[model samples]
Target: MSVSHETRDGVAIVTLQNPPVNGLGLATRRGLVEALAHALADASVEAIVVTGGARAFSGGADIRELNRPESGMEPTLPTVIAAFENSSKPVVAAIEGLALGGGLELALGMHHRVAGSRAQIGLPEVKLGLLPGAGGTQRLPRAVGLETAVNMIISGAPVAAGKLAQSRLFDRVVDTDVVQAAIEVAKEAAASGELHKVRDWTVEHPEAAVFLASARTAVAAASAHYPAPLRCLDAIEAAVNLPFDQGIETERAAFADLIQTPESKALRHAFFSERAAGKIADVGADVAVREVKQVGVVGAGTMGAGISMNFLNAGIPVTLLETSQDALDRGLATIRRNYEGSAKKGKLTAEQVEQRMGLLTPTLEYADLKHADLIVEAVFEEYSVKESVFSQLDAVARPGAILASNTSTLDVDRIAAFTGRPQDVLGLHFFSPANVMKLLEVVRGKATAKDVLATVMALSKKIGKTAVVSGVCDGFIGNRMIEQYSRQAGFLLDEGALPQQIDRAMEAFGFAMGPFRMGDLAGNDIGWAIRKRRYVEKPHMTYSKTADLLCELGRYGQKTGAGWYDYRPGDRTAHPSQLVNELIERHSTDIGLVRRAISDGEIVERLVYALVNEGAQLLQEDIASKASDIDIVYLAGYGFPVWRGGPMFYADTVGLDKVVAAMRRYGKGHEGAAWEPAPLLLQLAEAGRTFNP
Candidate 1:
């Protein structure tokens, strides 16, 4: 049984026993109700103390069970809460760790609640694109004031139990033995015969009408793309204005509506996908991970310094190497500046700044890396540069030390080949500004050992990253797919759409930035170099020369203050350049192509479907293990909007058949081979299957 019952001194102690996190799934809910019935049946049991063992009181509803048919099974959260509220015997909630979402609602249903001071408590359904369904909206407002309750419901961030002790949300905030305190409270309640129900209290504000109206306006403006926040505000308004029971019905009805929205579905998909991204099908739990204690980072450039910060923040000592003393000094200064900036922002203390900086050892010689358990080379993106670095690392590094390359787009196998031990080499592709970005693509080379892959994957979590394993391929999973997307963006430029138009359409579709804006921010010269290489590597690959012409004029993006858009000094804003527009027209004319107006809808579909089609190809080639893995990569790394899920999930929402049809239409206008739907997409479309399913 998920729940257990034991009576002590006329008080029935009902314990939720679900491990890890006590998710109130169907069995747990039913068990809770059954335990309650048993306690009420005995006249000797005058009161009940509900506790969720030593771990979490309850983390909330079982997210894995969400949307399943069994989720609505009898003794649902509402039914369970109703039992607690109506129980003849006083029910006291004993919260030890976390009481969140439905868990908090369960606590609110009880007559009394006693929590450990350190316990976390909240109704955080808004994060899952939901509002609380089981009387939380009504009762929370009654316990805490309308403003506090609304803020808690909207933000979905947990507050420590100690923070809410004065809010009447908790009957007692104890430093020790929460269940014992709850038992005492329940015993006292049983003796007093006074029923304290949150439902009986009135939700009041001095100027409730004014506050609620202002709140509704604010939420509507902030949550234009999301429907849940506005719905949450509406629920809170109902809590303040309507009767207790009517407010509950209002909240439930709103929840039922929001749960079915595409926004909610996307958020839920993102949540599950991130969790699934960490598990490798082939790498079992028993796979031994190499201990990564001392780490070495080569190249004291922007990428190198950021990579070093991740290890330092995790309390691992780092030996940062650069070819020149000046370079090494510059890198160390940047690292210190970054930490000092954090300290200034109140995110870190002065001692923490010094402590993290103290972990970094700047060196000019490669010999210092001999003791590193893992060495990540963040040198320039050149085959020759990488070859020299790896050859030297192979000679100087200790046996069994993992040699990793932080190459965004290069052959990991080729880098590994430079070293005698190919099994010890792999790619740890950290996105630019590595310390800030969460995605770490663990590129597994052909000869990479299982243990090495396991070690890197394990280390990824230690440093707080959502690691996705990728097979060695040109650009790996994210960039290879992004290349196609960028190609489509360039094609759109040739087809008569301006940069800002494409950006606005994509922003509307939920990309944080359009391709042009992103290119500008990341330095357009990077893509120029990649294209130059691609031109020699694959001569037949068609690409728009508009970008090359812009580069020819030295408009290399934000660093140069000009590219597809003009920028003033110190301002990153992209103002439309008439010169660039004329240049694009000239390029189109020179290529013997006529410019025509393009719709925003076409722009969104082409760019997004480009990612989806390439993602399907990656899945087919097994470069990516699963479709959701690709989604996680984009969601965590590429600024793909979380509310749209990822490209694959969005494709599923659009229906594979429709996506294929759109690709066919785009194929007629653009390069036909480039737009040819992937075989997997065609097969899935034919069978009416989704990538996720």
Candidate 2:
């Protein structure tokens, strides 16, 4: 909804009244169009000021509508922008907070743009497998020139209002009520007779061709599987060469094309899936979050230090507790070096680094945790070792302090059961190099309090991390899926496919890195340790004999210069090892398995189906809230390509019935244990339903 009226001085003000992000949905779009039409109809009005509800000007097109094609609600952005550009009276955009995607396009249509102190603008359509279709491609180039426009659009990066003003995109930027400032600018522009069309503004960058060519190459390299970036480049090029109206038609055609694409559907699924992942089974929006001012970190190793870094970065004081001065000193030295290195790299200032360092108080005692409000343990993966840590933490940490474990593949329930305050115990599984990774799997044990989960979720955002709430299970969401993915890859290798062929297939399918390459990067010994642990716990559980053979040969990974692939010293390129190939051949012959050439299609389907099967199981068991949560984990943590959306989205494109038949066929050929389809997958497949549903 929006309000429109002619002011006393012949200036019309149009204010969007939608709450939250004010995403331009059907009603909001209709309201905007009507408001503009009313302003344009009034002969007394000399100029118009476009503003927003409260803080946020707009987030973008209402994402809900992106997938709801049957809504019959075309975004009013294109129509409103066309009217604004062709209006008789000057239209001034007054931006506050974020004006992103179609929101920026709306501003670009106006004769002048005035942004507030905290205003940010960008075209982030690429993130959602889209390019701006509402005159953004044509007008932005005219406003900011070609090079800067293409970079901003392709990267989907937001530029601050101050920075945008320097780019000469916005006519003026001020630290005042944007509406009033826009009104003043509107009056001056009207008086000066500056009511000219922005479309008439020529876009003549001397290096336009070079910039577009470079952008095409860069985008192709960065996004090999995704079509959105390439399509975005095409639209930008249309704006450069084609006339204004033709560019607009080109944009519309491109947008319509993307709307029908599987990539767009998948990406849209991911966007909603991340939002849905925050919803917990027992926890509601009304759940209260605890006030955590001070934090206690146990085991100051790599995980512990990185976890503590997040706390300090969030401006929370931390008490880093270790067993010995030598260990504590090493942790402290690593923390200092990390911060100093960041400062050297221009990521942080020396002053900021010093300030963060001041927040940390390292102690070689459990007693130091007494005053802490939240205590997180990042000790060894052994349950007994973790139990001991939790027992001491429960005794010393203040009442109401949340006890968290950074265990990637351990049972959260077992750890919580060992503690007296089980209700306050939960799992905070941070991905490797925790400080760098954005995904944090927040596992809820049987007794984890609602407030505890909320606090952790809020804290994840505070530290610039996306927390996916998961029900406690061995490996939780991510590792469990990876287990299946790894199995599929190993099976492919055991069959006729080489490591190089398997890696190339997966990477070509849009994965940033293949399982083998990823394994090498993280060290193969990690998986070996996990497998060894699992086999010890449950001897009946299935174990891959192939990985064990590789481990036995001391082929760890890139760190050891050998794994499935050989790593050249000082180089990251993973080449298929002849030694590994020979070993696999001998092992296959020993096991009475005949090697046969495998197609890339078979490799892709096997690995993808493995992930899809596990994802279905997770969803059925309520380990994950939705199929999208699994996708988010893979996309953010496991380098699953953003364009394919995630494993489940890919499954939908493949068709559930087909996946079920393939899994059944494979299961029959192998043992039932080898290629068993998840019951959920079977159920959905039988019903002819998709995982996305």
Each prediction's total of clashing residue pairs, residues at least 3 apart in sequence or on different chains, is 0, 0
Return the lDDT, model 1, position 593. Answer: 79
Give candidate 2's error at residue 202 in angstroms. 1.3
Model 1 spans with C-alpha error above 4 angstroms: none
Q: Residue 109 in model 2: shift from native, Å? A: 1.8
The 10-residue segment of model 1 with minimum total lDDT is 667-676
TM-score of 2: 0.94
Off by over 4 Å in 2: 1-9, 37-45, 67-75, 166-168, 568-572
* Alpha carbon lDDT of each predicted model: 0.92, 0.85
Q: Which pairs of residues collide in candidate 1? A: none
TM-score of each: 0.97, 0.94
